[model samples]
Target: GKFPEISLDDYECVMAQVERQYNIRCYNLYRTYRTTKVRPIHVAPEDWQWLIDNLWSDEQFQKRSKQNSINKSKQEMKSLVGTINIETYEVTLVRNPETGAWPSAVDVWRAIYMKANGTWSIPNGAEILNNLEEAAETHKERIAAAPIPLAEHFALVLGRKPNHSRGVGIGAVNQGAQERYRIRARAEAADQRASDAQNQAAALLEEVERLT
Candidate 1:
């Protein structure tokens, strides 16, 4: 019996499927599976090890991966419409047959907002409708001058940032904020280490004086 030779295209297709299935990419996937001792369904343990040893370990790849994460986090306006993405919704939108004009982001948001409105206990929820109406009018005026995305429209009109922590409405994780939090956590750890070292030194000095 002989194993079939895997081509580059086959390898790439498998990797694509793995990414889609797991919602994770190379380095992170390696880290997660390695630490957890949980085997990935698609990748054999030996193949996973080979991938780690060969590809994910490269310094340039790791650097690029980190930068990609940072770049992704900086994108304030997440183009999501519930389970479906904005792009999919855009394609499905009923266009004006005569004008060939498509529905704007705000128009899509309004529909999403209606469905989600009753789910979460929004702060001053009753006033949201009034605010939305006002925002719509403002958005129309603003767009007449210059166009903006729905997330921006929400921020400008309704005063809601497109981060889940701020409020609910097709929001995304604020990656920059999360990065800042990690920085602060690291600083706190350093401070704790310094304090522990100082305390240990003091204890040693007291012990030496007692011995003398």
Candidate 2:
């Protein structure tokens, strides 16, 4: 039977929204689906069962669950942004008039923190500020490249290993696509260099033939 098609990005977005709405973690989404006994119209009965058998009960899935828990614990930056979606928050935020790009994650956090605590400076904020200060001194060129680092760019500023999403909460679902684009860009650049080298060689041969 034909089922409605959904792109992977769309599917992941839907799942993320569902998780946020229900206050359920991503790992526990399978359990929620199983408990509710609710299935999407597109999912066939057998396919749904396959998810339960192959994913819900799989050893690899369990391993990921454990890893996700560990990742959650390693998260040092807490936010006061609450349940507000990042995209929605961006609308109220001031963006660059020229580029129209949203502010950096650090700036966003500072704004949110200020709103909640009446100041950007928290009790232990000195520690974080000192770290950023040292990082800027040591990695001058790195900071110059990203004046306003958004999403995964915080990994560099915060000195923390990136989580699965390379972000704090409800990150963009197309992270995999972004990484793929980077890889493709590098490959294309390499191919272009090779082509340029071949063209240079061909031109040199033509000059030699004319001279000879």
Candidate 3:
């Protein structure tokens, strides 16, 4: 699409819009990158190999219910594998051999310059717009490659029991492990809540300072 005449003010407007959509400090797309690496059970859903290797342990579920546990583990493994779909959230550009770069930004500047100088020809404007369109397609491909979030990925790991070693042993051991997992889960949740509260307080302080 051909852009209307772009003044210097228009260029600044465009820059501000870009900054709003990105974090200038990080040099990474604010909306596209993972802001936090921490996970509920320290498992990254995107780490397919790690999730496959550790999500289910055969030894932990052995006993009278050994076969049942094994079957469940297999099913859980299958489910986890299927659940890990990558997310793609942004555009990427293939570099031009002549210029060693995608021409989207350059095209924008050229278009703005041409408009400013009153030398904006339709043919040149069309080429710039075409470059931007092609670059956008590449970015879409990159966005599609991103992995989706794994919500409560470790939830399946808790309360998983191994059969008692003896033919008639008490269930105390499995119960203890389950209890510990439950307690730790609660503790982690509390910690997350505290951290969230602190963040909110800090944001509020910044807002107050801005107003002052």
Candidate 4:
């Protein structure tokens, strides 16, 4: 009888399966399982640790993974009050009642502190947070009252439509917007084809049932 110590290749193979099954990085699978003491629904509970230990030394056992497409959509969402600074690592909010969408932390922080009244001092973080929370509630209520349909809402969430907190259907196509929109179109067409296929299958089954 022989027990096999997992090779790096085997560890990678399992991580690939975990990624395919759960749509997550191997690192996340390891961390979540360790911290929560709960089995990830997408991965086998038994081998999680073994995979973690074996794969930890690999350079690609990344600490932070790329934001997946869905999270990218969420990050682009305007309902979120503030953004994480990619460079200087500051969290900032937009206070302009006119524009709810502020994409850059440095620009916003400058507008509020550096140049607004020729003062180089920034306001307290809590003040900004409170202001945005109020604005967020108002925005939520307004969007709720708008005439957007459920189907259109799904499109917005999926990046089929542009990320618009203030305006719906405003997909100001960036450099790759056309490509993404095309992909969305293809996916929609595929979904329709799937529905048609399901219907045909059901009808065929019903006809067979009748014949028998």
Candidate 5:
């Protein structure tokens, strides 16, 4: 099919007809060109070329950046591992002179350290043995003559209770003292009641004599 070419006058007339039908204004075709105050659209060839080059280089930079980040993470992990790798020492179990039994230096040391660390339970054998050996060395004399009751020896020497529950001599003494105190209190109370009764009986006898 052959298409018809319309002249500028015919095109303008058609636009005017459409605008009139639609109740809108059409662009003027006969305006003269002038240097008006307006913002100009500027394009920089250098910047555009730079952006194109950068877009191409971005893949390499991103790959290197990702590798660097992974390397940094690996280095941090290695540092952490180095910090956590602690050396453990060997400890021996020696006979406690006071208790007359084998006392593990590791157990004692571990107990002390655990206590310091706010833990009540016994620590691993290695740590316990290490601490006990240290303690035994510090107090050699006390360890030599192992006392029958380890706890009592500790109390006597240290002026307080020992962590190990052995030979608590004061428990019976404390219980006896409490019983004696209770008995004394009861006796005092009974004496007071008996004295009051006697006083009442004497007053009753005096009243009877006066009436007679």
Candidate 6:
């Protein structure tokens, strides 16, 4: 009679026996059955306790979750490696109290000369001096290397000598020509020195890497 076709209580006991033997909880079985076409069933309290004890171990989950969070934070910081804030100041001149006027040409020129000579004063003064020095140096070099005596050539072309020419045109053509050639030669030498410096710097980097 198959033991009167086993009562529901008897079947549950058999299932519980199998669950214990396999170290699986009965709550898992109930959940699996509930997902099927079967009507919903409540998990037994004992089975629910068994599932909580086995699956919801707090220590293991927290360690893994914390490690993942730390790794993500490190990655975010690495992405911002070169991001930084910088401050800069702009130099500007104001009216001179004593002079009661804007800067004079001579004052501006002096500032420029000082800058080129690597001398510095106040921010405004240093900026102006640097610019002036660069311009004056460039002009002086150009004049010194002109194909002919600059003042004399200007006198010839303009039909009158510059106001303070010092009669350079009548003084020494040969000497002026030599000076022009010397200036060009010096410029070439300076360019070569710059190239050598760049090469040396590159070599130093390679040497450092090799030593390391």
Most lDDT-accurate candidate: 2
Tens-place lDDT digits, model 1, residues 1-212 = 49766645445555655664575555567667557957588878898787778867788877877796664454323322434333234335564689755455556554544445344233443465566567667667764443223434445544544463133232323443233334445656889899999999999999999999
lDDT of 3 by residue, 1-212 (tens): 59766545445545654764564432232112234433334335665345335432234522423565454344231111132111110022233679654333334324333455555443445454455455446554542332210111111111223532121121223333333334445656889899999999999999999999
Cα-based TM-score, every candidate: 0.36, 0.45, 0.22, 0.26, 0.21, 0.21
Sort by lDDT, best first. 2, 1, 4, 6, 5, 3
TM-score of 3: 0.22
Residue pairs with backbone atoms closer than 3 Å in model 4 (clashes): none
Rank by TM-score, descending? 2, 1, 4, 3, 5, 6
lDDT: which is higher, 2 or 4?
2
Instruction: Give the distance in Å from residue 162's predicted Cα in candidate 3 to where it truly belongs.
Output: 9.2
**For this target, which candidate reaches the highest TM-score against the unseen true structure?**
2
Question: What's the lDDT of the predicted structure labeled candidate 2?
Answer: 0.56
- 2 against 6, candidate with superior lDDT: 2
lDDT of 5 at 159: 40
Better of 3 and 5 by TM-score: 3
Q: State the weakest 10-residue window (summed lDDT) of model 1.
A: 164-173
- Cα lDDT listed for each candidate: 0.53, 0.56, 0.38, 0.44, 0.41, 0.43
Global CA lDDT computed for model 6: 0.43
User: In model 4, what lDDT does residue 83 have?
Assistant: 34
For 114-179, candidate 2 gives per-residue lDDT tens digits of: 556455544655455455456656765665564223434444545433332233442333454344
lDDT of 4 by residue, 75-143 (tens): 332222343322112123323557743333234433434544554443443354344445445455543
Model 5, residue 211: distance off in Å is 1.2
For 85-176, candidate 5 gives per-residue lDDT tens digits of 01011123334679845434334334333445455332343443444456556766764554322223333432433232222222212333
Residue 84 lDDT, candidate 2, scale 0-100: 39
Model 6 C-alpha lDDT per residue in residues 71-122, reported as the tens digit of each score:
4343221111231110000014345779745443335334333345555433
Between candidates 4 and 6, the lDDT winner? 4
